[model samples]
Target: MKFDTIIIGGGLSGMTCAAMLAKNGQKVALVTAGQSCLHFNSGSIELLGFQEGKVVERPFEGIAQLNEAHPYRKIKTEKLAVYAEEARTLLAEAGLKMKGNAEKNHFRLSPIGTTIPAWLTLEDLITLETTAELNGKKLLLANVEGFLDWPTAYLSDSLSAMGANVKTASFTTEALAFARKSPTEMRAINIAKYLDKAQNIADAAREINRLGKGFDLVLLPAVLGLAHDNVDLLRKAVETPVECVATMPPSVSGIRIENKLRGFLGQHGAVVLNSDTVNNGFFEGDKLTAITTEKLEETRLEANQYVLGTGSFLSGGLVSDYQTITEPALHLEVEAHESRTQWTSEYLFDEQPYMAFGVKTTDDFHPMKDGKAVTNLYAIGSVLSGNSGIKQATGTGVSMLTAIAVAHNILNQ
Candidate 1:
């Protein structure tokens, strides 16, 4: 089938945009690596641009001015503000909600609170068991041995303050019977995914229920029950109203968000082609024509415009390996010091301002390849002009807003 547009990469940016475009009644196709950087993200809408430093009183307004300053800075501030508004609306329509101000408000986040607002409490068994399809559930708190995670004592305190009734039991591969197989592993990261597969919620619940007599619900890590090959069984387990709460990185809220977004898109007739196609990019003159896939072979992606939201180095959104820090799409110059060796420090929280790298975009963010638009593709998020502290605060919101602006601009075109 012919599509109106083709998107590359399936991280948060790509999938979120796919949901928005499909909802807008456009024929969109997403080409992605399926489950890319989403695994390592914080899932919180970030904008750390000014939390601990210089604050752009009118953040979006500053983005417009950046176009003149750098190739990566080519976004219109007004458009970004509008995009943020729409992104919030869509997120709520999709089941999650972010409350508060763009500059002062926090979004709903999990695994780490305060960093992101709008987080629903997974600790509240009453809320999870009652509001969610789960009740009388047993939640598993799986943590990696010796890994520093957000304080559990602090989290439990917050949960109690919120009137939640939940208990946490932590075990390393050392304690569980599985420890014999592997010394260090997450139960949810490994085991739950398998059980959620080999046995349906009912069967496994029955089997495990037999082993440990208690609540009928089993709440575990976000990656739990779905990391392995056969995952449909885990889906079957949700039959008994089993639910998984969101967790920190390596298992950010990406999967949960993706699963929910896919449902929303499907209901609206949007077809999300998983990463099964051997796809290749086709450039026609100054524009991307159609994408060629192994299955479809060749097709037309005759859209008015495109949005690029692939993230930075860690997320594979941009290239930050060695002496370079540029997006292959625009080839904008990355702001680097004398040596790539100084890219980062071993201590992640050392606050070396130089380590947070990014592209310096043109006012319109088309990327200046020899002082011209690099194929009319607009770059956003970690791929474009950004500072780690600032970006850490607003990364998710930044991607959504910019993509929305790109879509709107395309509509006008």
Candidate 2:
């Protein structure tokens, strides 16, 4: 099939780019072998959580000091500012409203009651300046009947030690009848789906009213809703403010955002083909003309522009073997140490050198081969080298920013 742009990998980066490009009037197709990492995320967009072993208060300031080779540096400061604002607007319009901004990072409580700095968090999350803020607040945690992803009692105890009036209340089996009716024990996603229905949410809200009386705020597990914004519905039903704490994956929050993006892009006419991996690229001189997929080897997907966002080793953009590491698709040049021993630090908690390994690219995000740029083909997200998304807590940020940059570059062309 012919198109203006073909994005390999339907992960966050690829989908973000696809949506932007399609909105800008480019015909886009996104291909992926499996589900995106969004399903495994904590629903928070973390940007530069740590700097030189120190916690960062402001991520925008942190980006200024990033090494020249880091991916964020490629987009330039002015463009990054525009991209950040645009990304926030797009996400909010897609129905996954987020809080926080570029001025500073906000702290959100984790499942263990510890706070972590995040650039953008869902509006349903209770953000705090410090653990001390929880002190004296009448906080009630609503634990689902069989959800074991987080220990409510332990978290409540931890909060209590910090001077907060924390208490735990369980949603009895009858209250969670919607979840208990499932063939298997309810997971985060299942609970979220059940809560998506207005009737089920109203019923649960009534139950919360009975069990969560006199609390300043009711805290529920992240399974607030999946199909729609149930946070508002549930909040209105109970006539009290509600917040969701982070839980283990399949993250309901992440799925909600992913589904919203998918629906938004679908409405804009972008074709998303999952379970299809790009196997090889056909190049004419320095520009890629077409790509072949694993499922459809005989068919070539032709496009004027291509984006390689297959992600790092975790997503199979770069492959590591006993002898060497390689970028299998198009055999793009990978940036890494010559030996495996140098890939990691001696200390486990210290920065791992291997985390920064991926395809080396130019400022324009075109993959580099033997010190020359590969024309017409752009690389973004975890696939780009010179920065550690995991170490810096910049995975989603890097992916979204780079995707926006790539889309703008393509549009400008």
Candidate 3:
């Protein structure tokens, strides 16, 4: 198989690039090993959470202060803003509407009773600009009968401490029966799939109405729907505003958005090959010419340009064997310390050097080898060195913006 572009990972970064390129009439092929990190996503694009132990109010303003090796420093702030807005518009057009502005960050509650600062989030997410906004409001926190992801009691206590009039409610055993999974096996995805059915949604709405009365807004688990949006259904049924709190992995919000984007990409002309891992690539004079996957024996996929969005250690793009760290598929040189002891800090949350280990890249996103750029190969996402995405809370934003930048470069070239 041959195409204009072959993307080696099917996460948000690869999919966005494939969609954009295909929409512009490029023949694109997207290959993936399996499901993406989206399944574990918090369903929000966090530009930057903290800088030097201080929370960032406006992310763009801090980009200029980041170190020279930081990835954000390579991309102009204006381009970053444009990419974020474009990403929002793309997801909205695909049916997973998002909310937030380009210049500011907002706060949303996580399942563990922590507040997460994000640049953009789902429309159904509950965000409060300040704790003062909750002072005079009555709030309802909903708990699913079988799901243990959200601790409603703890959340209620936290909210009460924040000056809100808070109450806790639960979906009854009868309503939760639709989940099908036993309590021992039940999870957010099961509940979300059950809620996706119209009949089950109606039943849930009835229960919510009875339990959520007199509340200004109802905060439910993220398990509203799996492949569909059920926020409006519950809102209409209970005649009250409703929002969802981020839950544990098998994120319903993330699944919904991924489903929408996958469908959109399929419709646009990108051929997505899931459960396929690229085992080897044919390179000629610093240019990757073709790739062969584990599943295919006789065929090789050739492309004019290639994108590596395979992600970091967690996603199998980079691997460590205690003695050394290396990129598995391409054997790209990693930027890391020679001594393993220097890779980590005493405090896990501190600036750990190993967290930033990945392939070195140029400003144009091209992977570098011994100080020279690989002409036709580009790397993006967690696979790029110099940024600890988790510490900065810029994982999704980096993926989106870098993907957009790569797509723009490819199109312009």
Candidate 4:
């Protein structure tokens, strides 16, 4: 099999790159093992949420100050701004309605009630430029009766402390009640699956409307739009203004993004090998000639160019042992600590070195093998070394911008 580009890993980065290339008429193939980290997303894409232990109000400015090795440094700061806008437009074109820009970081309410800086937030979710936006307003937090993921008490206390009059309510429909019979399955994704029906949505809307009277805003868990966007349906059905807040993983909002992007790729004629793993890469000289997947066995899937967005240790992009870490797919050179002891920090909240450990790349995002650049293979997203995305709060931003930048590089060539 041959393609213009083969993307390993169908996470945000791989999907973004595939979508852009496929939209431009390039034949693309994306092989994904299973679910990506999108299942843990908070309904917000963050650029640079925190820098030097402080919240960043402007992300571009924060990016400018990032260390030389951070992935954002690979894309020129000026071009990053262009790619940021392009990224937003691409996502919007892919059917994701979002707000906020790369220049300014808005605040999204976290599952535990604190505010986190975000570059783009889902349109139906509540976002604030400042905490003062909550002052003197009435807010109602509504949750499913048996859903235990959303921390309502913490959110109420946080909102009340920020000068908002907050109230809490719980409601459940027959569908939701039926799901609650299994404690382990009462997650946001499962709840969303149960609520995909019109009757269930109407029942939920009726309950919320009864409890949400006179409230300025009704806040519900982000569990209404897994298969399709039922948030809009529920919103239109209820009289009160409704918005969604994120819940614990597996996040419904994140799954919605994954599904939408995967579907968009199909619509654009991209081949998506779902639940498939790329186990070996066929390299010749300094270039990756082709690759093989577990499902496709001996059949060599060839491409002119390939993208490795297989993610970090959590997603199995990189693996570690008692002695060393390695990029499992192609045995690409990884940037990590020499000793395992230096890979972590004694303090729990302190930044850990392993989060920044990934495949070493060049200025153009090409991975290196034996200290030489692999000409046709590029590594993007959390799979790239430098920048502990968790500490820097730049995971989604890096995933998106890097992917888009690489897509441009491939298109230009």
Candidate 5:
């Protein structure tokens, strides 16, 4: 079957591109072999240097500064700017909006706070992005009552800039409070306590609605509604529309982004496929046209465009354990070592996730062979290698941006 676009992975990055293309009225099919990594960590659509809707220079120069294993030591600054623009465009097209502007890095301390990295939020855009009713129209932010490390009034300031007069409500479920409670039972004191005080379904509804009075959104650390592998549950529990902003709790926001995107994409007609198994791929003069796997028994499909979003170590695109990337459809050249043993080691310095594995590409994120674009394919996300400097980096955001850039290349072509 012929398609306007064929995306191979089902991860956030891939799905982000597929969602945009499909939403814009493209015939797109997303393929994945199994589960995704989005649910594995906290969900933060972060940026290294983000503030007021712009992409600015980050203090950190390169990925090598963050970890020793970074494959390529540096990426040009101009390249990062292009990528930032691409990310913002992609999200905006798909209904997940963000700014492509420049600013400074803002990392939040935890239990739900905000960091104003260099990217910008709409000063007046925070009114109500969702359909759910907030505490009467004003946003209610709940965090540890006295948390010093947290980025306080961060998002609120941005929202206020947007004319969203919000109120802050400190609560006991702060990280410190939760830590004091028993590991298992602490949950009772936390999310459970929040629910119990409301007491009963009707009461819970009343409490959440009361809290939301004058607020159109509820900004909380990703903790409250992050259980049960679903973000929707929190909305159900709170009886109000919620935006589980973001926090540093091991990527809860990231996982939620993945879950929500997967379901949304499926409902919009994108096929998800993933697998550890390598399928035989065929190409003609460096252009991949077909692939063969056990499931399809050598079936092939044609496509007008390709967006490669195989992410970095976190996305499982490249690995030291596997020793080889197991070339997908293209027999593209990789920077593998002469001796597979030379590929990696147990040493932390040597085994840094940044280094050891990657698909070489140009600033445009298109794989290159002798300085020429490889077909109509656009490579994106962690697969490109480099550019993941610690200070001004957010993987999911990077993925979103890169996917946008790639889609821009594809659709415009």
Candidate 6:
């Protein structure tokens, strides 16, 4: 098999890069190993939420202050602004409706009800320029009866503290009740599956409408829109204005984004190999010639260029043994500490060194092998070492901007 470009890992970065290239008429192929971190998203894309222990009001300004090794530094601050808009446009083209921009960061209500800085928030979620916006408003917090993931109490308390007239309600349909029979399967995704039907959506809407009378806004757990935008249907059914708060994974909103983007890739003629893993890379001299997957053993999949967006340790992009950490796919050079003891911090909340550990890359985002840059292989997203997405709150931004930058590099070349 051959393609213009082959991207390993179909997470945010890989998908973004594939989508951009495919849209521009490049024959692209993407291989993904099941689930992505999008399952844990909060319905928002954060660009540098916190910098130097402070919330960043403007993402570009905060990105400018990032360290030399941070992925954002590779593109430089000025180009990031251009790519930021392009990323947003690409996502919009993929059917994601979002609010906010790269220049200014808005605040999205977290699962626990605290506000977090975000570059773009899904349209169905609540975003505020300031906490004062929540003051003096009538709000209703609604959740599924058996769903334990939604923190009703925390959300109510946080909203009330912001001076909002808060009320809580629980509503469930027959399908939702049926799903609750199995405790282990009673997750957000399961609830969303049951609630996706027409009758279930209408039943839930009726209950919410009854409880949401005279309320300024009705907030429900983000359990709608997994396979489709059922939230829109629910909103149309209920008379009151309705919105969703992000719930614990598997995030319905994130999954929706992934599905939309993946669908877009297919629509644009891109081959997507889901639930497949890249097991080996065939390299010659300083270039990666082809790769093989677990499913397609011995059948070499060749491409002119390759993208490694396999993600960090959590996603199995990079692995750590007793002696050292290494990039598993191609044995690419990684940036990490030698001693295992130095990989972590004493405090759980403190900065951990391992999170910043990933494949070392050049200014153009090419992965290195034996201290030499791989001519046709580029690493993007969390796979590149330097900044910790968890600590810096730049995960989504890095995944997106780096992917866009790499796509441009491939297209121009």
Candidate 6, overall lDDT? 0.90
Cα lDDT tens digits, model 4, 1-413, are 99999999988999999999999999999999988899999888999999988999988888888889999999987799899999899888888999998889999998988999999988878899998998999999999998899999999999999999999989988888889899977988889888888889999999999999999999999988578788889988999899899998889888888888888998999999989998899888999999999999999999999999999988999999999999998899999999999999999999888999999999999999998999999999999999799898999999999999999999999
The residue-level lDDT of candidate 6 at 197 comes to: 83
Expressed as tens digits, the lDDT of each residue in 1-413 for candidate 1 is 56665565566566677777788888876666566654654434543334344444444444454424332244454455556667767766776533344544323324532223321221211122112322333443333333334345554444444444545544333233443265344433444443344433344444333333343444434443443323234445343334343555555345445555666767777666675332455555666555565556655444555556656766555665566565554345565665866766777665564535666555555544444565556566656555453333455555666566566655555
**Which candidate gets the maximum TM-score versus the true structure?**
4
**Model 5 Cα shift for residue 49 (angstroms):** 5.1
Residue 169, model 1: lDDT of: 45
The residue-by-residue lDDT of candidate 3 on 1-413, one tens digit each, is 88999999988888888888988899999998888888888778788877887777888887678888887777876788788788787777677778877688888777765777788888887886765678878998877776787878788887888888998877754547744456754788888777777878888887778888788988888888887888887778777778888887878888877788899888888999989988888878889889999898558899999999999888899999888999887777789998999889998678888888888898888997656788898988888888888888878888888888899889998
Report the poorest 10 consecutive residues by lDDT, candidate 5: 122-131
Candidate 6 all-Cα RMSD: 1.5
Between candidates 3 and 5, the lDDT winner? 3
Q: Which one wins on lDDT?
A: 4
Ranking by lDDT: 4, 6, 2, 3, 5, 1
TM-score of each: 0.63, 0.95, 0.96, 0.97, 0.59, 0.96
What ranges in model 1 sit over 4 Å off?
A: 41-43, 48-50, 53-81, 97-103, 107-186, 189-246, 276-285, 290-303, 328-338, 345-347, 350-356, 389-391
| Overall lDDT per candidate, in order of appearance | 0.50, 0.85, 0.83, 0.92, 0.52, 0.90
Candidate 3's C-alpha runs over 4 A off are 173-175, 178-181
Candidate 5, residue 45: how far the Cα is off, in Å:
2.2
**Full-model lDDT, candidate 3:** 0.83
Segments in model 4 whose C-alpha atoms lie over 4 Å from true places: none
Tens-digit lDDT track of model 6 for 1-413: 99999999999999999999999999999999988988888889988999877898988887778889999999965688899999999989999999998889999988889988999989988889998998999999988887888899999999999999999989877777787788976788878787778888999998898899999999999888477678788899999999899987778888988888988999999999989998999889999999999999999999999999999988999888888999988899999999999999999998889999999999999988988999999999999999799888899989999999999999999
Expressed as tens digits, the lDDT of each residue in 1-413 for candidate 2 is: 99999999888898899989999899999998877888987778876777787788888889999999999999878887789988898788677889988678888777777777888898887787665887788989988887888679777887788788988887853546655776474888777777777888888888888888788888989887778878888888896678888887778878877888888889889988879998888876788889999888889899999999999888888999876889888888999999988888999888999899999888899997656788899999999998788778888999999999999999998
